[model samples]
Target chain A: MFDIRSSIINQKKYKVFYAIIPFLALFIALFIGGVLIFFAGINPWKAYNYMLQSIFGNIRLFSEVFTHFVPLVFCALSFAVAYKGGFFNVGGEGQLYFGALTATLAGVYIQGLPAFIHIPLVLLTGFIGGAFWCWIAGILKIKLGADEILNTIMLSYLAILLINFVVMYFLKPANSYISQSEKIAKSAYFPKLIPHTQINLGVILSLLTVIIIYYFLYRSPYGYQIRAIGENSDAANYAGMNILKGTMTVIIISGGLAGLAGASMLMGTQYRLTPAFSPGYGFEGIGAAVMARNNPWGIILTAFLFALLRVGAGAMQRGVGVPLPISWTIEGIIMILITGSEYLSNKFSTNLIGGRA
Target chain B: MKKSKVFLRVFVLAFAILMIFSTLAMTAPLKIAIILPHAITSEGWTKSGFDGLMKAKEDFDIETSYQENVSEGELKGALRGYIAEGYDLIIVHEMGYNDPTLEVAEESPDTMFAITYGFKAADNVAVTSGTNWQANSLAGAVAGLMTKSNKVGFIISNDSPVAHNFLNAGFIYGAKRINPKAEVITTFVGSWSDVVKGKELAKAMIKQGVDVIYSQCGVVNRAVIEVCEEAGIWAIGAVEDMSYVAPQTVIANALAPTEYLVYGVIKEMVEGTLKGGRVVKGIKDGAEEITFNPLLKDKLPENGEEKIMKLRQEIVDGDITLEQMQEELNKQNIKF
Candidate 1:
């Protein structure tokens, strides 16, 4: 009993350490970024100062950041939920696209319904569409033992082609010059939360989603089962957990969350579905999930950081005259440093504990 | 106390080094930056823009610098960086930069900024665009006359007004003039560089009995030309004379000849003749034309060259306007 208590305490301590490590790594990345700025013949202090100003300076830019943040939060949450259940969902992009496609179809085809009914129906359709697509991969993994990673990636390509076909052949607008779906019904759109700035109810939905996900992952029976399976699949099975059912549930939920991200992007921002609709938010969510170590609150923080980078990078381009490709380089560097630091700290602590033992 | 002194000395040394570098950078002659929408290795579209900057550097004795593969989201930041660095002129090589360029122009009124494709005018911002629609219409006239199946296709990169006006309108109007019953089908591959998707779309159109294709996209058209050649269908190229890529099947090309436009703009900028407003270049200004593939010379219809020359003259004389083309099409009840 004493040994169990001590082991639990040790695990809790390690969890805290793991949580704090990424933030430290981020600071280190900023320092390296400063060096890069200096090498580029610009004052590092002014560059960083301008970056901050660009992020928080005006209502329009700040709102734009938050606008980008909403989808990221939802995508990160989706990844967090599945990650906690030990399922690696690489199909978030496909799921998001399908969600947008379904929401678009709902917005176009489903008419005569009241705003209250139409809006929610469209959002729900997005969730169901994404979940259904993900369930295909889940079913394959659980039933046929196919690799979820490969299956999900393949499905993403198919989903893109499928959306293109639908937009071109079936949902094509009257103009027919542009191969895109018709404009979504005005009633289907999410109302702007902040006027004049693209900030919509999607941000609120994303926040609520984070809270809900936190509760679902940490405070519920199903959540416990998920965590248990994540910790050790064999042990979870030994404890009378239904492995296939748990897998299916997590996969579907993960896909649904990603789909919600698509719904948020479509209804809140773009009013119509375009080919370049997603700026790779689904894949970016995976980065957030990894950086946050699969914690709901952590995912939120990391997602905001990424949003800052994206928005600030835009300002950086306009303000600093740095090429846009440099932003990708900066992001790639930051990710590498964070992941590398985590690896190093884990190894260091493991060695220390083993030595003490 | 000793450690503190050591730290202070090191800080002082670093400050001095930074100051020296800053002075050297500031005193440097001309700082010009170019932001391209696509990678240098991708194709000639962006490379042509960069080449213009390079030529300007040699002629005007200006420092030339560039960045490639810039997305819409990152364009503003790239512009800001160059402005902060005090670049004399910043050229953004893409149409999507219109909105971001407007914002940046307002922020840095002193910076002379130029963009291709889309037009958003400011005191310091200049918009340069090609007569792509006119050139496409010219190419369309040729495709309309030559196609064996009376069905032509267009591979659109994305759903933008500029792209829509050029390919769809031109094809429809031109097709109706030559072959009233001609059916024109268009497909958007959703990207300017998605060759695989472009090929697949062209193949699908071919399967639907489309015998001639006009690809308005830049690099993506490479696949369309390839697929058309393999399938023995005629294809129209965009920008440069891509007829050489697959000479046998590429019947003609809608040429932008960005090199001439870029050179002209840079020369005007140097001569202080570049006005800060929308500048529209067309066939009348020798900015765009249709280059017939030499390989297809024998296969051309007997009166093809003569008919095209007459239409060009009528267009230039304003006797046959683009609006008139649309009006004629409406009279025939033809839709793209």
Candidate 2:
């Protein structure tokens, strides 16, 4: 209920309240995270000191955070776009694997081409692969009245198993132990920006995508149609919009965004596909999407926080022997507090204005 | 313009705080670190490595830290993080860490590294390359002597030359040495943890009249042993003492002590004799050997224990060598 519609109470005051929610949630969650460290018999101050130093002390270490952030951004956008269009496309994990599989095939099997040609072509294949996989769930939604949330979640497992089988049985090189595909072509690589660091063109691509997606959703007439469908599908239907076509389009775009995430990861960091290659990046993006309130620009910030927490988890382990789960605990707390605060603030504002109270 | 000035002030404060903590982190002495690919509580390969790390920490009286359950995707970054923290020796405790270790080692020439199950090496990297085949060879000899059906089975973790030379070819070669009529059957499970596939493979081998089986897959080893127990047959355990899993079924337990590999690297580091190449140790160095299960001592087929023990001694005395076994593998064209 504390969505964009909350602006009906008082737009300027609501803006200030929404803006403060993330920082307030983060601060409270980190405080709780310190309590956890205290209970675990670790010096909470020392644990936090190490975490902060590892995250922001040096340039390369800081840049490494973006390595995880890039894939998350794509996945967050994937969820955000779909959520805005009145769909819960929770199949980002499957869509990502589908993209990575197709991208791997294209990158490995295709003949020599210029970097310019091959890169875009590989990315296109990834998008098509993810979009097509998600389209199955979308079609089921409109035609068979299937719940996409259940379908996408289950499809993730199936997608992972199928990709593993294909790679293990077919694409694995001789004299190898792990289930992984052969390395992709060099031409398809997202060019690295720093020596011995994973900072690459993927970062630029993600930023560009943020601005583009933001503009499309807020500025374009088509984006308004998608938002309208989410607000009231029957009203959208009465508005003479083809609800089926509009819904399917949003789902496809959502899946394509996640597919781009897979492609970026493949092109940026991992040059090969392996079983469970994502490390739950797709699932994490849902947290980012929800925490960012499905805003394209806000998703970037939330994704960065997710990346920092993961990196900080390693720092805590390395610096003070804090277990890896504490950072994850902090992330879970942030999501919960953000949701709770948003709800509470919405109710407070409604009560103040005597509009919905 | 006013907001920009405030942002600049906060940035400077944050940077200053970061510098102090980073410098504080740099004061550890002769630190050794281990990077484990799986959870230590898994009670398998990763657990053995952690035990060795602790043993090294105690024996050498040196500072040691470890990071376990690190995935392959994050391996490069994890390795770099340790190097940045100035760990002198980073023991990468998995075969999957091979490629990433090579890359990180190339970047940091001063830092020493020991990669368990790793293949390639560089200027500062020494790999834990021991001969598990020696133990497999001896187990093959014992299985050959014990089997009445003249069929022995080896359920390997995967199809590779390492698995072949270490777990299969040496197995077949030693079986024929003791019983020329012994037919050694080998099958690949394509995974170290696939219980169902391992179970199916064990059943199929049992159907083929194999009364004695050697299974090298990790969790699948338990599955195979249980199947053998249900069928009232014999099994050979690998890597560690697995007799308690099924006392009657596991007749002989073959151990290619992976802990020794870890201990050996720490020893070399202390002795200032660590070199960048394959460190091949086996029965002679007490890194590989076989232990017979006492629960099945009555089923030892009279002097079966002696014959296997003498063969192990011959291996230790250098009268029998892994090179000879490697040649046998070549002659048999049994490269997986």
The local distance difference test score of model 1 is: 0.77
Q: For model 1, how does the per-residue alpha-carbon lDDT over A1-357 read when each residue is reduced to its tens digit?
A: 986677667767776777677777777777877777778877777877887886676665677677568888888877788878888888888898899899888988887788789888998999998898888988888889899889887887788777766776677665454455666788888888776565788888888888988998899999899889988999999999988788788998899988888887878766666554577888888888888878888887899999888876666655664555666677777789778877887786676455232
Query: What does DockQ give for each predicted structure?
Result: 0.12, 0.27
Tens digits of per-residue lDDT, candidate 2, A115-164, equal: 99999999999998889889988999999999999999988888877887
Q: DockQ for candidate 2, please give it.
A: 0.27
Give per-residue lDDT, candidate 1, residue A340. 89
Model 2 chain B poorest 10 in a row by lDDT: B158-167
Residue A345 C-alpha lDDT in model 1: 71
The numbered model that scores best in DockQ is: 2
Query: Model 1, B72-137: lDDT tens per residue?
Result: 444554665566557877877876556557766887787888777655677887878775567778
Where model 1 places Cα greater than 4 Å from the true spot, the runs are A1-17, A31-45, A108-119, A169-172, A176-194, A355-357, B1-132, B140-190, B195-215, B220-237, B240-253, B257-281, B285-287, B291-308, B318-336
Distance from true location, Cα of A280 in model 2, Å:
2.0
Q: Which candidate should be chosen as best, given TM-score against the real structure?
A: 2
Candidate 1 deviates by what RMSD? 8.1
